[model samples]
Target: MKKTPNFKMFMFLMVVFVNTSYSQDVVYSAIFKNVNKTAENLKHHLNTSGDTLYLESKFDLNRIEIIGTDGLKTFAINNITKDIRVPLNSLPMGDYTFAVVQTEGRDDTYIYTKTIVFKISRLLPIDMDISRGITPLNASIYLAGGTIPILDLAENKIITDFPAAMDLASMEDNKPVHLDYTSMESLVALQEKENLDAKHLRTKKIDNILERNKPAYSKAYNITDIRSGNQNIQSRADYRRNNLRPNGLPYD
Candidate 1:
């Protein structure tokens, strides 16, 4: 018996063919050195209050396009100069690829394109807490950013209903804590109390020593002399310190 043609397979093949064809037509050329340099010098500022993405470029931009990770265009601009500020509050929080095309020379002979990827994350205030365990703490936990969620794991299951913030008294004991989010993938638990105290004491000691020796450092560096209003007197003092003659003799 003759087999029937697969309609679903045929539709899938058609979709793939059209997508591949479209992608081939929109190929991105390698970024030119000048354009790449300009992009490297570009400064990006995210203004949360204004909900805008401020971009400052060194060179003239022919086009600026923001493309989602799914290959969909979200925003675009053309014939923009050194400064381009686009509102980004409407866009969802995720990774986005920015394509910048620049032109140079009177005839716009030199064309360059550069692509940069950036992530937009939701701003959430993270609260952390620590408790003492039965054993004396020997290690210290260092937290870099204050945005990771703290989790507790005991019997191979993750505890999510733990308190957002907790106050543990001195000499109190509790179980080890884990991180709920992948942002703290490298971290295992919070620092123990004894270790934390030791670190704080060391930091305090160093700060105190610095404070005590501050006068010596100031005397050795003497940067305040440069800020003095008398330029003529300062110049003469500098010349004398270098043993240069006051008769405008160029020091060899």
Candidate 2:
């Protein structure tokens, strides 16, 4: 038969496990990128409160100590590496301060970490070789001194050469370009001839309509004089109409 475990000891062990777990979210290293800014100039972030500060720094990889606060002394897991992630959900509920310290010897100096992390596994680009101590923080193109990013991420698709021909007459500026599809020598000449013929026919039709619609009247003249030859007589209306004058002919 097995003996029963101590209840008080079991509870104490549980508390220790919870606190240690919460303290593992913070994994840090000596920030080697970005311009150094003073504490007064740096932007600080907030915690969920009553959280235990479990900063895991380079495990003497870069050698630093931390979690010092205005009211608390934060601790770092000296065995933590550049690969371990800060488990945010495991953080303890507490008040703490964050600072950027210079950590070359043993003091934990935190600056702009210049760090970017992606948690998804196994689906990264094949050219992205962040294994055996390589990481995106040092391999991203957007960062200074970083290596070339994923081979496929270079956007080689749009580099294709599209063979295109451009015509000035088909383009638009402030003054629009109007295109005429009709061939000038053959088609335009035929069109012009057709228009002239149509106009002449229309004019003849109008003249016929006017002649039919006008009022009817008769013209006459009386013989007032006999010619010297006595073969023809002169009529006044006929004389005036038939004669040409300096001022021009009068209306009959």
Candidate 3:
């Protein structure tokens, strides 16, 4: 017997709900912190074909615009800061200027822009050579870097960080710095010791099994895979049962 809700009342409630929803415009700023001051500009150029320009910055980004002699391209978003992925396949080979803009609280705004030059080219290979010897194995260091990469050819692994401590930009004449062979010798010795320990543990396990099964082997079981138990199905468990004792030498 109550009065039904009318269309006018429903419409009025919806209008109030939409107005009360939370929404705000994006605002942001950025600062460059790299120490290599000799590099003149904040922007860096890339020449890869059909690649994207990943612009990374800390700011509440509203829109980023790329301005070239051809025209202007704008990318807009609602975030405070975001990566602007600019595809370069469509543009002609040349230089361009990019502008990054951000807004805060609907009124505050800021902008950063820089000119970047880029060119397209074929990638070159790198080369390598033995740099120095610190030890027998670990110390033997190799250096490689050229327009053409140096193929290892021997181990089939790309050579990286020869001097170990030096960064790429700090290398003199783009030549790799190798570590000493003394380091290599120590590594080899450690490996040999580990192998010896494993052999010793294996011998002890076989001895223990023989002792336990000797009483049973002479009577019924032949020790030829007598099915020790289902628990021995796992390689690790089998290895332990065949090599270790309840009170034997610690495996490590």
lDDT of 1 by residue, 54-167 (tens): 566666655555555456553333334565545343445443445555544344564565544433322211111122111211211221112222111112221223334556
Report the Cα RMSD per candidate: 28.8, 29.3, 25.0
Tens digit per residue, CA lDDT, model 3, 1-252:
121254335434544543353132110111122224532333433312213344444344455555556677665544443334443434454334455554433434635433232222111111111122111111112233222122232333323334435655755678876768998899899999999999999999999999988742222223454555432333444455556454886444
lDDT for each candidate structure: 0.42, 0.33, 0.40
> What value does the lDDT take at residue 69 in candidate 2?
24
Candidate no. 1 TM-score: 0.29
Report the lDDT tens digits of candidate 2 across residue range 1-252. Answer: 121254335434645554454333221111211233432222222122211112233322222222322343333323323322222222233222233232324335542332211111111232323343323222222211112111111221111222344555633455765547755566778989999999999999999999999975433344554356534445566667777655786655
Name the candidate, 1 or 3, with the larger lDDT value: 1
lDDT of 2: 0.33
Comparing 1 and 2 by lDDT, which wins?
1
Backbone clash count, each prediction separately:
1, 18, 31
Candidate 3 off by > 4 Å = 1-50, 104-252
Question: Which run of 10 residues does model 3 get worst, by summed lDDT?
Answer: 121-130
